[model samples]
Target: MEISVFSIQKSKADNFENEIKEYIKMSSKFAKISDLTIFNEKIAKAQSAGSESALKSYDDIYEPNLKGFCIALDEKGEKLDSIQFAKILESNSQISFFIGGAYGLSQNFKQKVDKIISLSPLTMAHKIAKLVLFEQIFRALCINANHPYHK
Candidate 1:
Protein backbone atom coordinates (compact mmCIF):
# COMPACT_ATOMS: atom_id res chain seq x y z
CA MET A 1 0.00 0.00 0.00
CA GLU A 2 1.15 3.49 -0.84
CA ILE A 3 0.17 6.25 1.55
CA SER A 4 0.37 9.78 0.22
CA VAL A 5 -0.11 13.05 2.08
CA PHE A 6 -1.13 16.01 -0.08
CA SER A 7 -0.65 19.11 1.95
CA ILE A 8 -0.91 22.79 1.05
CA GLN A 9 1.86 25.23 1.90
CA LYS A 10 5.51 24.54 2.40
CA SER A 11 7.07 23.63 5.73
CA LYS A 12 8.31 26.94 7.17
CA ALA A 13 10.00 25.68 10.31
CA ASP A 14 13.15 23.62 10.21
CA ASN A 15 12.13 21.65 13.27
CA PHE A 16 8.83 20.65 11.70
CA GLU A 17 10.59 19.31 8.61
CA ASN A 18 13.09 17.40 10.73
CA GLU A 19 10.36 15.86 12.86
CA ILE A 20 8.42 14.77 9.80
CA LYS A 21 11.55 13.25 8.32
CA GLU A 22 12.19 11.30 11.52
CA TYR A 23 8.72 9.78 11.45
CA ILE A 24 9.03 9.01 7.76
CA LYS A 25 12.29 7.21 8.43
CA MET A 26 10.67 5.24 11.23
CA SER A 27 7.70 4.31 9.08
CA SER A 28 9.98 3.17 6.25
CA LYS A 29 11.51 0.53 8.54
CA PHE A 30 8.25 -1.37 8.11
CA ALA A 31 6.47 -0.39 4.89
CA LYS A 32 6.66 1.63 1.70
CA ILE A 33 5.70 5.27 2.18
CA SER A 34 5.92 8.45 0.16
CA ASP A 35 7.17 11.84 1.16
CA LEU A 36 4.62 14.54 1.92
CA THR A 37 3.93 16.45 -1.30
CA ILE A 38 3.25 20.14 -0.95
CA PHE A 39 0.78 21.74 -3.32
CA ASN A 40 1.67 25.41 -3.31
CA GLU A 41 -1.12 27.91 -3.71
CA LYS A 42 -1.02 31.68 -3.49
CA ILE A 43 -2.38 32.98 -0.21
CA ALA A 44 -5.26 35.41 -0.15
CA LYS A 45 -4.14 39.03 0.01
CA ALA A 46 -6.62 39.98 2.72
CA GLN A 47 -6.40 38.41 6.16
CA SER A 48 -10.03 39.28 6.81
CA ALA A 49 -11.18 37.25 3.83
CA GLY A 50 -12.54 33.96 5.05
CA SER A 51 -10.56 30.82 4.21
CA GLU A 52 -12.69 30.31 1.14
CA SER A 53 -10.05 31.49 -1.28
CA ALA A 54 -7.33 29.27 0.15
CA LEU A 55 -9.75 26.39 0.30
CA LYS A 56 -10.60 26.91 -3.35
CA SER A 57 -6.95 26.96 -4.20
CA TYR A 58 -6.52 23.67 -2.37
CA ASP A 59 -9.45 22.19 -4.25
CA ASP A 60 -7.97 23.16 -7.60
CA ILE A 61 -4.63 21.61 -6.75
CA TYR A 62 -6.09 18.58 -4.97
CA GLU A 63 -8.85 17.45 -7.28
CA PRO A 64 -6.74 16.09 -10.09
CA ASN A 65 -4.42 13.74 -8.24
CA LEU A 66 -7.18 12.41 -6.05
CA LYS A 67 -7.31 8.75 -6.84
CA GLY A 68 -8.12 6.01 -4.33
CA PHE A 69 -9.51 6.90 -0.92
CA CYS A 70 -9.12 10.53 0.00
CA ILE A 71 -9.20 11.39 3.70
CA ALA A 72 -9.67 14.94 4.82
CA LEU A 73 -8.40 16.26 8.12
CA ASP A 74 -11.35 17.71 9.91
CA GLU A 75 -12.32 18.66 13.45
CA LYS A 76 -15.70 16.95 13.38
CA GLY A 77 -14.60 13.74 11.69
CA GLU A 78 -14.27 10.39 13.42
CA LYS A 79 -11.42 10.27 15.90
CA LEU A 80 -9.35 7.10 15.67
CA ASP A 81 -6.96 5.73 18.20
CA SER A 82 -3.55 4.47 17.12
CA ILE A 83 -4.74 0.86 16.89
CA GLN A 84 -7.80 1.71 14.84
CA PHE A 85 -5.70 3.83 12.59
CA ALA A 86 -3.41 0.85 12.14
CA LYS A 87 -6.37 -1.17 11.00
CA ILE A 88 -7.13 1.46 8.43
CA LEU A 89 -3.58 1.29 7.18
CA GLU A 90 -3.74 -2.46 6.96
CA SER A 91 -7.08 -2.56 5.17
CA ASN A 92 -6.69 0.07 2.54
CA SER A 93 -4.67 -0.35 -0.65
CA GLN A 94 -4.05 3.26 -1.56
CA ILE A 95 -4.84 6.01 0.90
CA SER A 96 -4.36 9.72 0.39
CA PHE A 97 -4.57 12.18 3.26
CA PHE A 98 -5.17 15.88 2.75
CA ILE A 99 -3.99 18.66 5.05
CA GLY A 100 -5.59 21.87 3.97
CA GLY A 101 -3.99 25.29 3.73
CA ALA A 102 -4.35 28.07 6.32
CA TYR A 103 -8.05 28.25 5.64
CA GLY A 104 -8.75 24.54 5.77
CA LEU A 105 -10.25 22.30 3.06
CA SER A 106 -13.09 23.49 0.89
CA GLN A 107 -16.56 22.00 1.24
CA ASN A 108 -16.23 20.56 -2.28
CA PHE A 109 -13.09 18.67 -1.34
CA LYS A 110 -14.64 17.55 1.91
CA GLN A 111 -17.67 16.27 0.06
CA LYS A 112 -15.56 14.10 -2.24
CA VAL A 113 -13.33 12.61 0.42
CA ASP A 114 -13.98 9.02 1.39
CA LYS A 115 -13.39 9.63 5.07
CA ILE A 116 -12.76 12.59 7.31
CA ILE A 117 -10.38 12.11 10.23
CA SER A 118 -9.82 14.48 13.10
CA LEU A 119 -6.41 14.46 14.68
CA SER A 120 -7.63 16.60 17.56
CA PRO A 121 -10.50 18.85 18.48
CA LEU A 122 -8.23 21.81 19.05
CA THR A 123 -7.21 23.63 15.90
CA MET A 124 -3.62 22.91 14.95
CA ALA A 125 -1.35 24.75 12.60
CA HIS A 126 -0.68 23.13 9.20
CA LYS A 127 2.92 22.32 10.01
CA ILE A 128 2.05 20.78 13.35
CA ALA A 129 -0.71 18.82 11.74
CA LYS A 130 1.74 17.28 9.29
CA LEU A 131 4.09 16.31 12.08
CA VAL A 132 1.27 14.85 14.12
CA LEU A 133 -0.05 12.89 11.17
CA PHE A 134 3.40 11.57 10.33
CA GLU A 135 3.95 10.44 13.90
CA GLN A 136 0.56 8.75 13.96
CA ILE A 137 1.35 6.96 10.70
CA PHE A 138 4.61 5.73 12.22
CA ARG A 139 2.80 4.62 15.37
CA ALA A 140 0.21 2.79 13.35
CA LEU A 141 2.91 0.98 11.39
CA CYS A 142 4.56 -0.07 14.63
CA ILE A 143 1.27 -1.47 15.91
CA ASN A 144 0.64 -3.38 12.71
CA ALA A 145 4.13 -4.86 12.76
CA ASN A 146 4.14 -5.64 16.49
CA HIS A 147 7.10 -3.38 17.00
CA PRO A 148 8.18 -2.21 20.45
CA TYR A 149 7.58 1.42 19.58
CA HIS A 150 3.85 0.86 19.85
CA LYS A 151 4.02 -0.54 23.36
Candidate 2:
Protein backbone atom coordinates (compact mmCIF):
# COMPACT_ATOMS: atom_id res chain seq x y z
CA MET A 1 0.00 0.00 0.00
CA GLU A 2 1.00 3.60 -0.50
CA ILE A 3 0.31 6.52 1.82
CA SER A 4 0.51 10.16 0.84
CA VAL A 5 -0.17 13.30 2.82
CA PHE A 6 -0.81 16.67 1.18
CA SER A 7 -0.67 19.74 3.37
CA ILE A 8 -0.40 23.54 3.21
CA GLN A 9 1.87 25.28 5.68
CA LYS A 10 4.88 27.51 6.10
CA SER A 11 8.28 25.96 6.70
CA LYS A 12 8.40 23.94 9.88
CA ALA A 13 10.88 24.40 12.70
CA ASP A 14 13.98 22.29 12.15
CA ASN A 15 13.12 20.05 15.07
CA PHE A 16 9.61 19.46 13.75
CA GLU A 17 10.97 18.72 10.30
CA ASN A 18 13.56 16.30 11.57
CA GLU A 19 11.09 14.45 13.77
CA ILE A 20 8.61 14.15 10.94
CA LYS A 21 11.28 12.72 8.68
CA GLU A 22 12.23 10.21 11.35
CA TYR A 23 8.65 9.10 11.72
CA ILE A 24 8.27 8.73 8.00
CA LYS A 25 11.43 6.69 7.82
CA MET A 26 10.09 4.34 10.45
CA SER A 27 6.65 4.17 8.86
CA SER A 28 8.09 3.51 5.42
CA LYS A 29 8.80 -0.06 6.52
CA PHE A 30 5.07 -0.67 6.44
CA ALA A 31 4.12 1.07 3.19
CA LYS A 32 5.28 3.37 0.46
CA ILE A 33 5.04 6.88 1.88
CA SER A 34 5.11 10.41 0.48
CA ASP A 35 4.31 13.89 1.71
CA LEU A 36 3.59 17.03 -0.28
CA THR A 37 3.79 20.40 1.38
CA ILE A 38 1.77 22.96 -0.49
CA PHE A 39 3.51 26.19 0.43
CA ASN A 40 1.58 28.94 2.15
CA GLU A 41 2.37 31.47 -0.55
CA LYS A 42 0.58 29.50 -3.23
CA ILE A 43 -2.41 29.01 -0.99
CA ALA A 44 -2.35 32.69 -0.04
CA LYS A 45 -2.64 33.64 -3.67
CA ALA A 46 -5.43 31.11 -4.07
CA GLN A 47 -7.16 32.37 -0.93
CA SER A 48 -7.23 35.84 -2.42
CA ALA A 49 -9.31 34.22 -5.10
CA GLY A 50 -11.05 32.09 -2.41
CA SER A 51 -10.36 28.80 -0.62
CA GLU A 52 -12.63 26.90 -2.93
CA SER A 53 -10.67 28.01 -5.94
CA ALA A 54 -7.39 26.93 -4.36
CA LEU A 55 -8.89 23.61 -3.41
CA LYS A 56 -10.12 23.15 -6.94
CA SER A 57 -6.58 23.45 -8.20
CA TYR A 58 -5.62 20.73 -5.71
CA ASP A 59 -8.51 18.57 -6.89
CA ASP A 60 -7.33 18.96 -10.44
CA ILE A 61 -4.09 17.30 -9.43
CA TYR A 62 -5.17 14.65 -6.90
CA GLU A 63 -8.84 13.99 -7.47
CA PRO A 64 -8.50 12.20 -10.76
CA ASN A 65 -6.83 8.79 -11.11
CA LEU A 66 -7.32 8.19 -7.42
CA LYS A 67 -6.76 4.49 -6.81
CA GLY A 68 -7.46 4.52 -3.08
CA PHE A 69 -9.29 6.28 -0.30
CA CYS A 70 -8.91 10.03 0.21
CA ILE A 71 -9.07 11.57 3.67
CA ALA A 72 -8.89 15.10 5.01
CA LEU A 73 -8.14 16.35 8.50
CA ASP A 74 -11.18 18.41 9.31
CA GLU A 75 -12.49 19.86 12.56
CA LYS A 76 -16.03 18.69 11.98
CA GLY A 77 -14.98 15.23 10.88
CA GLU A 78 -15.28 11.90 12.62
CA LYS A 79 -12.88 10.66 15.29
CA LEU A 80 -11.00 7.36 15.23
CA ASP A 81 -8.55 5.92 17.72
CA SER A 82 -5.21 4.36 16.83
CA ILE A 83 -6.57 0.86 16.35
CA GLN A 84 -9.28 1.95 13.98
CA PHE A 85 -6.83 4.11 12.09
CA ALA A 86 -4.48 1.19 11.62
CA LYS A 87 -7.39 -0.81 10.32
CA ILE A 88 -8.10 1.87 7.72
CA LEU A 89 -4.56 1.74 6.45
CA GLU A 90 -4.39 -2.03 6.37
CA SER A 91 -7.59 -2.26 4.41
CA ASN A 92 -6.51 -0.01 1.57
CA SER A 93 -3.89 -0.35 -1.12
CA GLN A 94 -3.53 3.42 -1.50
CA ILE A 95 -4.50 6.29 0.76
CA SER A 96 -4.16 10.06 0.58
CA PHE A 97 -4.70 12.66 3.26
CA PHE A 98 -5.25 16.36 2.72
CA ILE A 99 -4.55 18.98 5.36
CA GLY A 100 -5.82 22.32 4.22
CA GLY A 101 -4.45 25.81 4.68
CA ALA A 102 -5.11 28.03 7.71
CA TYR A 103 -8.63 28.85 6.64
CA GLY A 104 -9.46 25.12 6.41
CA LEU A 105 -10.89 23.19 3.50
CA SER A 106 -14.16 24.11 1.86
CA GLN A 107 -17.34 22.03 2.14
CA ASN A 108 -16.90 21.02 -1.46
CA PHE A 109 -13.45 19.66 -0.73
CA LYS A 110 -14.61 17.86 2.38
CA GLN A 111 -17.50 16.26 0.53
CA LYS A 112 -15.17 14.95 -2.15
CA VAL A 113 -12.85 13.14 0.26
CA ASP A 114 -13.65 9.55 1.24
CA LYS A 115 -13.36 10.34 4.93
CA ILE A 116 -12.89 13.47 7.01
CA ILE A 117 -11.12 12.90 10.33
CA SER A 118 -10.49 15.03 13.40
CA LEU A 119 -7.29 14.54 15.34
CA SER A 120 -8.65 16.63 18.12
CA PRO A 121 -11.48 18.97 18.92
CA LEU A 122 -9.13 21.92 19.41
CA THR A 123 -7.69 23.80 16.46
CA MET A 124 -3.98 23.89 15.64
CA ALA A 125 -1.60 25.44 13.15
CA HIS A 126 -1.29 23.46 9.96
CA LYS A 127 2.45 22.93 10.38
CA ILE A 128 2.15 21.59 13.90
CA ALA A 129 -0.89 19.62 12.90
CA LYS A 130 1.15 17.88 10.24
CA LEU A 131 3.55 16.64 12.88
CA VAL A 132 0.74 15.31 15.00
CA LEU A 133 -0.78 13.56 12.02
CA PHE A 134 2.52 11.99 11.09
CA GLU A 135 2.98 10.73 14.61
CA GLN A 136 -0.44 9.16 14.62
CA ILE A 137 0.24 7.50 11.31
CA PHE A 138 3.48 6.12 12.66
CA ARG A 139 1.76 4.88 15.74
CA ALA A 140 -0.81 3.16 13.62
CA LEU A 141 1.92 1.40 11.72
CA CYS A 142 3.51 0.25 14.93
CA ILE A 143 0.21 -1.08 16.15
CA ASN A 144 -0.32 -2.98 12.96
CA ALA A 145 3.05 -4.64 13.20
CA ASN A 146 2.47 -5.61 16.84
CA HIS A 147 5.41 -3.43 17.75
CA PRO A 148 5.81 -1.95 21.19
CA TYR A 149 6.28 1.58 19.79
CA HIS A 150 2.61 2.28 19.98
CA LYS A 151 2.28 1.80 23.72
Candidate 3:
Protein backbone atom coordinates (compact mmCIF):
# COMPACT_ATOMS: atom_id res chain seq x y z
CA MET A 1 0.00 0.00 0.00
CA GLU A 2 0.97 3.60 -0.48
CA ILE A 3 0.13 6.10 2.27
CA SER A 4 0.67 9.81 2.53
CA VAL A 5 0.06 12.11 5.48
CA PHE A 6 -0.52 15.77 4.63
CA SER A 7 -0.34 18.34 7.38
CA ILE A 8 -0.83 22.10 7.22
CA GLN A 9 2.29 23.28 8.96
CA LYS A 10 5.77 24.46 8.27
CA SER A 11 8.61 21.95 8.48
CA LYS A 12 10.12 21.68 11.90
CA ALA A 13 13.34 20.33 13.36
CA ASP A 14 12.25 18.89 16.67
CA ASN A 15 11.79 15.76 18.73
CA PHE A 16 8.37 15.09 17.25
CA GLU A 17 9.88 15.13 13.78
CA ASN A 18 12.54 12.65 14.89
CA GLU A 19 9.95 10.33 16.40
CA ILE A 20 7.78 10.54 13.29
CA LYS A 21 10.79 9.58 11.19
CA GLU A 22 11.37 6.55 13.41
CA TYR A 23 7.78 5.39 12.87
CA ILE A 24 8.14 5.87 9.13
CA LYS A 25 11.28 3.76 9.15
CA MET A 26 9.55 1.04 11.13
CA SER A 27 6.58 1.05 8.77
CA SER A 28 8.75 0.65 5.68
CA LYS A 29 8.41 -3.14 5.71
CA PHE A 30 4.64 -2.89 5.40
CA ALA A 31 4.07 -0.01 2.99
CA LYS A 32 5.52 3.01 1.27
CA ILE A 33 4.68 6.15 3.30
CA SER A 34 5.51 9.83 3.21
CA ASP A 35 4.69 12.95 5.20
CA LEU A 36 4.11 16.20 3.35
CA THR A 37 4.27 19.41 5.37
CA ILE A 38 2.53 22.39 3.76
CA PHE A 39 2.76 26.03 4.72
CA ASN A 40 3.42 29.21 2.80
CA GLU A 41 3.11 32.98 2.98
CA LYS A 42 -0.50 32.72 1.87
CA ILE A 43 -1.40 30.26 4.62
CA ALA A 44 0.52 32.36 7.15
CA LYS A 45 -1.44 35.43 6.21
CA ALA A 46 -4.73 33.55 6.44
CA GLN A 47 -3.86 32.21 9.88
CA SER A 48 -3.09 35.67 11.11
CA ALA A 49 -6.51 36.84 9.99
CA GLY A 50 -8.55 34.40 12.12
CA SER A 51 -9.67 30.81 12.55
CA GLU A 52 -12.39 31.01 9.93
CA SER A 53 -10.03 32.43 7.33
CA ALA A 54 -7.40 29.87 8.15
CA LEU A 55 -9.89 27.07 7.72
CA LYS A 56 -11.02 28.47 4.38
CA SER A 57 -7.42 28.69 3.29
CA TYR A 58 -6.91 25.08 4.31
CA ASP A 59 -9.87 23.94 2.25
CA ASP A 60 -8.64 25.79 -0.79
CA ILE A 61 -5.18 24.29 -0.62
CA TYR A 62 -6.17 20.76 0.41
CA GLU A 63 -9.25 20.22 -1.73
CA PRO A 64 -7.24 19.91 -4.91
CA ASN A 65 -4.75 17.50 -3.37
CA LEU A 66 -7.38 14.94 -2.35
CA LYS A 67 -6.47 11.53 -3.67
CA GLY A 68 -7.63 7.91 -3.34
CA PHE A 69 -9.11 6.83 -0.02
CA CYS A 70 -8.91 10.28 1.46
CA ILE A 71 -9.28 10.68 5.22
CA ALA A 72 -9.27 13.84 7.28
CA LEU A 73 -8.49 14.07 10.96
CA ASP A 74 -11.19 16.11 12.67
CA GLU A 75 -12.18 16.50 16.30
CA LYS A 76 -15.85 15.76 15.61
CA GLY A 77 -15.17 12.69 13.48
CA GLU A 78 -15.84 9.10 14.38
CA LYS A 79 -13.43 7.33 16.69
CA LEU A 80 -12.19 3.96 15.49
CA ASP A 81 -10.39 1.17 17.26
CA SER A 82 -7.00 -0.02 16.07
CA ILE A 83 -8.41 -3.16 14.45
CA GLN A 84 -11.04 -1.15 12.64
CA PHE A 85 -8.42 1.28 11.45
CA ALA A 86 -6.32 -1.62 10.20
CA LYS A 87 -9.24 -2.83 8.10
CA ILE A 88 -9.26 0.41 6.13
CA LEU A 89 -5.57 -0.09 5.34
CA GLU A 90 -6.15 -3.68 4.30
CA SER A 91 -8.72 -2.60 1.75
CA ASN A 92 -7.13 0.50 0.29
CA SER A 93 -3.94 0.41 -1.73
CA GLN A 94 -3.62 4.16 -1.75
CA ILE A 95 -4.54 6.29 1.25
CA SER A 96 -4.10 9.95 2.09
CA PHE A 97 -4.56 11.32 5.60
CA PHE A 98 -4.98 15.03 6.14
CA ILE A 99 -4.06 16.80 9.35
CA GLY A 100 -5.44 20.28 9.37
CA GLY A 101 -3.84 23.47 10.66
CA ALA A 102 -4.22 25.00 14.14
CA TYR A 103 -7.67 26.34 13.34
CA GLY A 104 -8.73 22.85 12.31
CA LEU A 105 -10.38 21.65 9.13
CA SER A 106 -13.52 23.19 7.75
CA GLN A 107 -16.78 21.28 8.14
CA ASN A 108 -17.33 21.28 4.41
CA PHE A 109 -13.86 19.90 3.79
CA LYS A 110 -14.38 17.10 6.28
CA GLN A 111 -17.75 16.30 4.74
CA LYS A 112 -16.18 15.99 1.32
CA VAL A 113 -13.53 13.50 2.41
CA ASP A 114 -14.02 9.75 2.15
CA LYS A 115 -13.72 9.34 5.90
CA ILE A 116 -13.35 11.54 8.91
CA ILE A 117 -11.51 10.20 11.97
CA SER A 118 -10.56 11.52 15.34
CA LEU A 119 -7.34 10.48 17.03
CA SER A 120 -8.60 11.80 20.32
CA PRO A 121 -11.30 14.09 21.61
CA LEU A 122 -8.83 16.43 23.21
CA THR A 123 -6.97 18.91 21.06
CA MET A 124 -3.26 18.39 20.42
CA ALA A 125 -0.43 20.34 18.90
CA HIS A 126 -0.02 19.86 15.15
CA LYS A 127 3.39 18.19 15.49
CA ILE A 128 2.20 15.97 18.32
CA ALA A 129 -0.87 14.99 16.34
CA LYS A 130 1.34 14.07 13.38
CA LEU A 131 3.53 11.92 15.62
CA VAL A 132 0.50 10.09 17.02
CA LEU A 133 -0.95 9.52 13.56
CA PHE A 134 2.36 8.08 12.32
CA GLU A 135 2.60 5.70 15.27
CA GLN A 136 -0.96 4.52 14.75
CA ILE A 137 -0.38 3.99 11.06
CA PHE A 138 2.60 1.82 11.87
CA ARG A 139 0.57 -0.10 14.42
CA ALA A 140 -2.30 -0.59 11.99
CA LEU A 141 0.05 -2.02 9.40
CA CYS A 142 1.44 -4.44 11.94
CA ILE A 143 -2.03 -5.56 12.92
CA ASN A 144 -3.00 -6.22 9.33
CA ALA A 145 0.16 -8.20 8.67
CA ASN A 146 -0.17 -10.21 11.87
CA HIS A 147 3.16 -8.79 13.00
CA PRO A 148 4.24 -8.83 16.63
CA TYR A 149 4.78 -5.07 16.72
CA HIS A 150 1.11 -4.42 17.34
CA LYS A 151 1.05 -6.56 20.46
Best by TM-score: 3
**Tell me, what's the RMSD of every candidate?**
2.2, 2.3, 1.1
- For model 1, the superposed segments whose C-alpha errors exceed 4 Å read 39-50
lDDT of 3 by residue, 27-143 (tens): 999999998888998899999999989999999989998988999998788899899999999999999999999888998899889999999999888888889899999999999
Q: Give the distance in Å from residue 94's predicted Cα in candidate 1 to where it truly belongs.
A: 1.4
Q: Model 1, 1-151: lDDT tens per residue? A: 7788877765455638777777878787676677566544255442136677666667877888687778899888899989989998888878889988777877888999999999999988777788899899999888888888887
Error of 3 at 91 (Å): 0.8
- lDDT value, candidate 2, whole model: 0.79
Query: What lDDT does the true structure give each of the candidates?
Result: 0.79, 0.79, 0.91
Q: Which is better, 1 or 3, measured by TM-score?
A: 3
Candidate 2: residue 3 Cα off by (Å) = 0.4
Error of 1 at 62 (Å): 0.6
TM-score for predicted model 3 compared with the true structure: 0.95
| TM-score of each predicted structure versus truth | 0.88, 0.86, 0.95
Residue-level error in angstroms, candidate 3, position 62: 0.7
Q: Best to worst by lDDT, what's the order? A: 3, 2, 1
Cα shift from native, residue 25, model 3 (Å): 1.1
Model 1 TM-score, 2 decimals: 0.88
